[model samples]
Structures are given as structure tokens and as C-alpha cells.
Target chain A: MKRIAYPAAIQALIGELKRLPGIGPRSAERIALWMLQSRDARPLEVSRVIREVQESIHACPRCGFFTTDTLCEICADTTRDAAQICVVEQPTDILPLERTGVFLGRYHALGGRISPLDHVGPEELRIDALIERIKAEAPSEIILALGSDVEGEATANYLATLLRELPVTVTRLAQGLPAGGGLEQADELTLSRALAGRTAVKG
Target chain B: MKRIAYPAAIQALIGELKRLPGIGPRSAERIALWMLQSRDARPLEVSRVIREVQESIHACPRCGFFTTDTLCEICADTTRDAAQICVVEQPTDILPLERTGVFLGRYHALGGRISPLDHVGPEELRIDALIERIKAEAPSEIILALGSDVEGEATANYLATLLRELPVTVTRLAQGLPAGGGLEQADELTLSRALAGRTAVKG
Candidate 1:
């Protein structure tokens, strides 16, 4: 069936919007049209924000976390524990961990994990920068707060092997059943890991 | 929980992105970060398209469809029938009907339907423009292709009553089970409508 042809500019905007995650063709079309039809200057405002963010935001010099300034906020804060550093796969991972409020140390985002299938290796990530930070800061512990996925495991293992002779101790996140998770819903592997990683309860 | 503070520009962008439909806080953060971290000039490209679409697209003077030119593509086409106009509640509704390839008539987008709950009346819609077009063109028939919702039904009935004194005939989209829809899964109302509107089977 022949489709109703939108203007070239509208079509282009829709196509670009569809490139974003979770945006489909219908969603892109709706957003584009809504922007165009907005009574206020919403389209111009959105454009300005996108351009400004792109021009200003970049990876922190010390850590891989995003920042407009030369260094990220965490890196610039002297009050945070310098002796401890938590390493994560990407900058997005830092937020959830921060929400937990369990760790008081600073963070080092690895940009991404080492994925062999995707042709991404240690060189592609911020592994070198992480090593340099360890050497310079001499952190007492490096907590690898990575996903339980294969790539995350591989990256943590690679870092552990690389830092075997280093002064700092390396550890990974514990593997077990999730908080409030039902035993019936827990997969066999997760149940087994939970059993193996059980800790002694206080009397 | 102490959150890692993103740069002001990045945070502003994320805030603006969260205003879009279906986008939550996490999705906004991911999209904002993705745009900033994009190796290519994707952010710039997206910005350029948004600006272009905003500047160029406007409502069609005749049919209220979005167009860069004075007339939309459908209105500009000579092959389509001008004497039969299909009316819809919004410009977005036009596309799906076009895909059916069933009708080859011109369109009249009412912009919105009459909704007393939302304080929307016939005057708030493009009803006047529709009446003017009908008077000028004296179309043989007008088809109201609106949603099956309450507001849609109200608008259709109101339009039917308004056009009763006019010269042209009026009709609406058929009510029944959708094409390729299974009888077993069909809702009671839909099944009843299908039965009531059933046509004679030819040998």
C-alpha cells in the first residue's frame, strides 16, 4: 500500500529519532509531529539542549564518567575515600550503585567491558587508565561492581590477573539470589550460588 | 544515596529528554549519554534534523495535514477523488487508512473531536473549515473515519446531525470483527456487530 508521504525534513527527523533506543517508527513519527506542532518553542529548546550537551559533555580525564568540566564531580571531591575505588562497566552503572549508598569510595567507569565477540578488548576500554589510577592513588581495595554476564566476568578476571602482583586487593560482587527473590523463581544456578555463598548468622 | 552528579549540560539534556512520551528517567539518561558518547557526529545530525523539521513543516491550509508547501502531498495529487472526503479526528489517523488502499478520496482532518469532558466543542475543531470545503466542493459523500471510542462516536453523531441538512450523503467506518481476526478471540460486542452487519454470501 502507498504510504502518505511526509515532508523530507519531517521524515529525516523521524528517521534520526528512530535510531535512539526504545524508539520505533511509530514513536519517532509521533514525537517528530508533536515537536513540530508544539505551541511553545519546544523543538528549538530540545535542539539547543542536544547540541549543548554534545558540545560540553565528555569523559572525565581521570575516570571514564561523563563531565562538562575537565574532571568529573566524584574525581574533584576530596572528601570521598581516596583509598577505595569501585570499578564499573559503564558510566550508567555508577548511578544504581550510588543509589544503594553502600559504598563510600569514588568510582572508575571502564567505558565498557571486554567483549571478544563484539571485537572489543581491554584496549577499547579504560583498563589502562584504571591501572594508572591504582598506581597513583594506591587504593587499598578495588571493588569490581560489574554485571554477572560473561563479558563482565571476563573483564573482572582479566583485571584480577593483571593486578595479581600489584599492592591493592581486588574483589568482585557476590553472586547469589537477589533481594526479596522467591526460591521458586530462583534459577538452579542462582540457588546453587546462594547456597555456596551463604554466610554464618550471628547468635 | 549520594548520586554521581552529571555535568549541568548533560543533566539539563536528560531533564528535557524525560519530557518526551514513554521516556522515563533511566531512558532519558541512557539516551543523553549515548548521544554524548557517540563516536560519529550523530548528536549534531539529530539536532540539525530537529531544527529543520521545526522550521519547514506547517499545517496544510486546505486539509490541516503537515506540509512544507502550501498543500500536503495528498491534496496536491490530481489522481485522488476530490468529490469524496474522508474525515478524521487527527492528522495521524490519515496514514493507517492510506495503508489500506481502500479509498482514493481527499481527507479533512478535524484536528480533534468534540469532548465536553475536556471542554472541547465543535468550535475548537476544524469544523468550520470542513463545512466551507463541503459547501465549495459539494462532495457526493463524506466518510467519518474516526476511532471507536466514546469521543469519536459523539463527534461522528454530531457531524451526522450537522450535515443532515446539507446536500451530500454521510457515512462512517463499518463496525465488526477486524480482518484476519479469529471468531474465538472476538469480543462479544464485536461479534454482535459483525453478525448485525453481515453481508449475503454469493454462490
Candidate 2:
């Protein structure tokens, strides 16, 4: 017997859903079927919202965070500490740090890190924009909140070297045991880093 | 510090994405961001395809499978066996069986099985339609390809009882250790069923 197939429209929907980060073929198909069958037309609403976001949202010129207006909310806020700027690899990373409520300063999204294998170098990233912002704003401290991975470390090192001539103090997030995490669950590299970066406790 | 939030359009997109089956808050945010940032405008195409599908596709009046036309491809095909109808719980279930290429018979989707906890009853399913099809077509066999869960069993039993008056042989998919599944992995119930339903080796 000839193989059965989904209608052309459904097939197209599945094809598009599969392009998302984590969705696979089976998941795409399942989501497509749900979109076609769900009672409330939620997928249609999602599609509309996607279009709206695409049309309205753009990267902030200074910081690279998503924004509808001239600058992102963080950049637009006058109350934030202009003397400090936290650097991260991507725009998505800003929210987690913001949620911590410890950092009341502005953020600079690198857009991506230096990965030679992927042909992503300093030129491809928002490094030039970040440097220009640093020069103009004259922040007292620049904190690097990038990942511990090889690519993140390389990018951080490259940025640190470039910013060394500047007047601002360059710092990186501390590598140590995560809060609420036990030492037993820590990897060897993490344990070593925690030991090397151990802070003196004051009574 | 005030909590940082996504732009209204992005937040709305995330909310709509969260309504999909497997998408959670973080995944929704990721997808929404991707939709906003992706260079090719794929998500926009997906939205258009979803609207197209909603406008064109409907459950086939005969077999209940999704179709752009009056009848689904399966029901419209003249070469398929009309005398042997396979009964399944959902239209989605038909695709997997169809891919197996073993069964040449047309299918009847019951939409869902009897689930008292969820307030779904026999009346909620397509049992009446199956019976009507049986009476009209006078099919020689009705294959119950529903799940092995309690609701599926109850539904199968109910359908069997309902269709007993009609001149049709109602058979169910066999219960045994799944193909490629080992004895050690098989559950006790499955083991017992496998033993009881052991077939004779003709070779």
C-alpha cells in the first residue's frame, strides 16, 4: 500500500515547527496536530504574537537587549548605576541576572562569543558597540558574566585584553560551588575552582 | 530593583507558546526570542501556514481523519479494503499504523476513549459512527487498535458489546511483549499475557 501523508498545510506547519531550537520531527508533528485540533486556536494566537514581536522588537543600539522603542528598558532607566556594566554572551542571559536583584547596573549583550570553529570572531559580535559604550559612559567597573566553557573563556580573555588599556577595572564572575548545591554533586573542575577561589569568612 | 520583563509583544508570544503541549515558561521564552530574532522570518511563515490549515482542514465526514477536501485520502481511496475497518482512538494514531504498511484496511477514529475521571464517556467518542459504518458497509472485521490502558480497554469492551448485534467480527490488537523488548524489561502483566497468548511455531 502507498504511504499515508498529512495534508500539505499540516506538513508545512510541521516543517516550520521543526526549525525551533529543541523541537524534533515527532515533536513538530505532535505540536502541528495540536495546533490543528486544539479548541481555542492557541497556535494561531501564538503565530500572531510572533509576528507582532518580530515587527515591534529590535535590539537596543547600545546594549543589544530586545526593545520596542529607542532603547531597551534597562538602557532607558536613569536610576540604574551608570558606573557599572555587566557583560554577558547573549540577550537572554540578562533576565536571570536581573532576577537575582543583586545587580542594579546596566547590561551589555555580546550577541555571541568568539568561536573560531563556528567562524564567530570579535568582528561578528557586539564587541565594538560595547567598547564604544564603555569609552563614552566611562563605567568604573566592567563585570564579565559569561559561561565557563572554552568559547566563553576565550571571549572573556579577548575582551579583558582589549579593555586592559582602558581606565575601568575589569572583573569576571567568581567560579565556585553553586548555592544549594552539595560538594558531592560538583564536578572535579568546579571543585578545584571553588577551592582556588575560596573567600575568607569574617566573623 | 524592579523585576525586568520582556516587551509586551514578546511576553504575549511567550504566553501563547506556553499553551502548546510540551512548551514551558523558559522554552516559550526561548522560542519567542528566536521568532523575534531569526533572520529568515520562518515563524511568520509558520503563522501563515497555521491560518491556512485552520481555514482549509477539517475532519473527514466519513473517517474523521484531517482532510482539506470532503473526504480524507484514506476514505477517498478506492483500492483500500472497505470490508475490514480498523478502529483507533485518535486521528493521530492512524499515521503510525499506516507507516507500518501492514494493514491495507481503511480506519475509523473514535477521537478519544472512555475516561470517567476526565468526564469523557462513550457518547463523547465516535462509537455511534463506527456502528453506523459497520451497518452500512457490512465489514467482515473491526480491529480495535486502542491503547492498553484501563480507559482503552473499557472502550474496546463497550464497542465489542455494542457491535455484537451487527454481523461483524470484532478483534483487538494482540497484547504481548513489544517487538525488540526483552523478557527482563517486560512487566508482570505483559509477561503473563505473553505466556497466555503464545503462538504455535508452524516451522
Candidate 3:
């Protein structure tokens, strides 16, 4: 007997859905079916919104953050502290730091960290742009907010060396146990980092 | 401090993405970001495919399956056995049964089962069309290949009662330990059903 196959349009839609970050074959099929069969216009709304975003949004030239104009919101805002610039690997990383409400400074997205295995070097990142920004804007501090992984460390170290000749103080985010995380869940590296970075009690 | 929020377009896109089945806030944000930042034209392709599917695909008028034409492929095919009509809850359910390579008959999708709690009645489903088909085509057997859940059982029993006076025989898929499933994993209800429906040895 000849095998039954999904129509070409449906198969194509499923293939597209599977390219999403976490969606697999079964999830793609389910999503495709839902989009086709759902009573509401949500799927169409998604398509419209995607087009709207694509047409309007672009990366900020100065900071590498998503923007609709000449500069991103952070870069454009006059009230944000220009003396301190927090650096991160990607634009997505800025949101969490903003949510914390601790950092009132502006941000600079590096696009990605330097990874030798992935063939990404300093030249591939926004390092030159960052150096230019430091020279022009004269921020007192450059806080490295990259991850604690090997690539993150290498990138931070490399940035610190590059910025050494400049008049800015380079700092990195402390490596330690996460807030609300229990000691029992801490790995050996995390425990050692916590111990090494311990601060004196205020009392 | 003023709270930082995503731009209006990005937020709208995230909201739309979250409406998809199984996608939550984080997943929606990730997908929205990926769509905005991906180097390839995949996101635009998805938008185009969605529009294409919406414009072309419609439920088959006769069988309620997805089709771009007058009737679904299964319904259009003349070689399929007209004597046996398999009934399913949704059009999506037919694919798995088709993949099993056992059933070669035409299918009737009920669209959904009779669920009083959800206010879905027989009138809301394709029961009338099924009965009409039975009277017009006079198939030999009607197989209820629905899930073994409460709603499925209620629907199957209701259909059997409704079709009692008809010339066709009513049957359902067997309830037992699944193929490749161990007896130890079988629940009490499944075990009881397996025992009650045991077939005689062929030796």
C-alpha cells in the first residue's frame, strides 16, 4: 500500500517550525496542526508581528542592542550614568541586569564572546567599536558581565589587557553562588569561588 | 528607577509567539529574538508559509481532513476500502493510524468527542454527516479508533447505541498492554482489560 503523506504546504510549515530553538519533529507537527486548525487568528497575528519586527527593528550601531532609531533606548537616555558601561556577550543579556534594578549605567553588547574553537576572535566581536566608545565617551568603569565559562574568562581577560592602556578601570562580575541558591546545590568550582570572594559581614 | 521594557514591536511579537501551543514567556521571548536576529530568511519563510497554508488549506468537506482541493487525498483515492470506515476524534489522529499500515479504509473525523464538561455535544461534531454517510454508502464495519480516555469511551458507547439499528457492525480498538510495553508498567485498569480481552492461543 502507498504511504500517506502530509500535503506539501503542511510539510513545509512543519519543517519551518522545527528550525525554532527547542522545537522537535513531534512539536513541529503539533504546532503546525494547531496553527491550521485553531479557531482564533493567533497564527496570523504572529506572522504579522514578525513582519512588523523585521521591518522596524535593527541593531544599534553604537551598542549592538536592538533599536528602531539612531541609537538604542539605553544609549539615547540622558539620565543613565555615562560614567559606567556594563559589557555583555549579547543584547539578550541586558534585560536580566535591567530587571535587577541594581545597575543604572548604560550597556554595550559585544555580539558574542571570543571562542577559539568556534573560530570567533576579537576581530569578529565589537571590540574595536568598544575601544572607540571608551576613547570618545570616557566612561570611568567598564564592567565585564560575561558568563563564568572558559570563553567568557578568556574574553574578559583579553578585554582587560586591551583596555589596560586606556584610562578606564576594568572590572568583572564576581563568580560565586547564585542568590537564593543553596550551598548543597553548589558545585566544587562554585563553592571555591564563593569562599574566595567572601565579603565581611556589615555588623 | 524606570523599568526597562522591550520595544512595542518586540513585545507584540513575543505575545503572539506565546499564543502558540506549549510556548511560554521565556520560549516566546527566545523565539522573538531569534526571528529578529537570525541571519537567514527562515523567519520570513515561516510567515510566508503560514499565509500560504491559511489561503489554500481547508478541512475536506466530506471527511473533515486538511486538504487544498475539493476532497482529501484519502477520500479521493478510489483503491481504499469503502466497506470499512474508521472514525477518529481529530484529523491529526488519522496520521498515526495510517502510519501503523494496518487500516486501509476511509476515515471520518468527528472533530472532537462528546464532552459535557467542555459543553461539546454530538450536534457540534460530525456525527450527523457520519450517519448520513452510513445511510448513503452502507459500509460493512465502523471502527472507533479513539483514545481510551473517559470522553472517548463515552463517545464510542454513544455511537454504538445510535448505530444499533444500522446494518453495519460497530467495533473499537482493543484495550490492553501496549506493544513493547512491559506488564510491570501496566496499570490495574489496563491489566484487567488485557485479561478480560485475552485471545485464545493459536497452537
Q: Which model scores highest in DockQ? A: 3
lDDT of 1 by residue, B79-167 (tens): 88888999999887787788888889999999999999999999999999999999998899999998888999999999999999899
Which ten residues in a row are the worst by lDDT in model 2 chain A?
A: A39-48
Fraction of native A-B contacts kept, per candidate: 0.74, 0.73, 0.61
- Candidate DockQ values, in order, are 0.55, 0.59, 0.64
TM-score of 2: 0.86
Model 2 C-alpha lDDT per residue in residues A153-185, reported as the tens digit of each score = 999999999999999999999999999899899
Judged by DockQ cut-offs, the docking class of candidate 2 is medium
lDDT of 2 by residue, B1-203 (tens): 46788888888888988888888898888888778668786877878887888888899988889999999999999999998999999898999999999999999999999999999998998888888899898899999999998998999999999888989999999999999999999999999989998999999
> What are the per-residue Cα lDDT tens digits for candidate 3 across A4-54?
878899999999999998888988898999988887787788778888888
Error of 3 at A95 (Å): 0.8
lDDT score at residue B28, model 3, on the 0-100 scale: 89
Candidate 1 wrongly placed segments (more than 4 Å): A1-3, A182-184, A188-203, B1-3, B182-203
Between prediction 2 and prediction 3, the one with superior lDDT is 3
- Give candidate 3's error at residue A123 in angstroms: 1.7
By how many angstroms RMSD does model 2 differ from the true structure? Answer: 3.1
Clashing residue pairs, backbone N/CA/C < 3 A, model 2? none
Give the C-alpha interface root-mean-square deviation per candidate.
2.6, 1.7, 1.3
lDDT of each: 0.88, 0.90, 0.91
What's model 3's overall lDDT? Answer: 0.91
TM-score for each of the candidates? 0.88, 0.86, 0.92
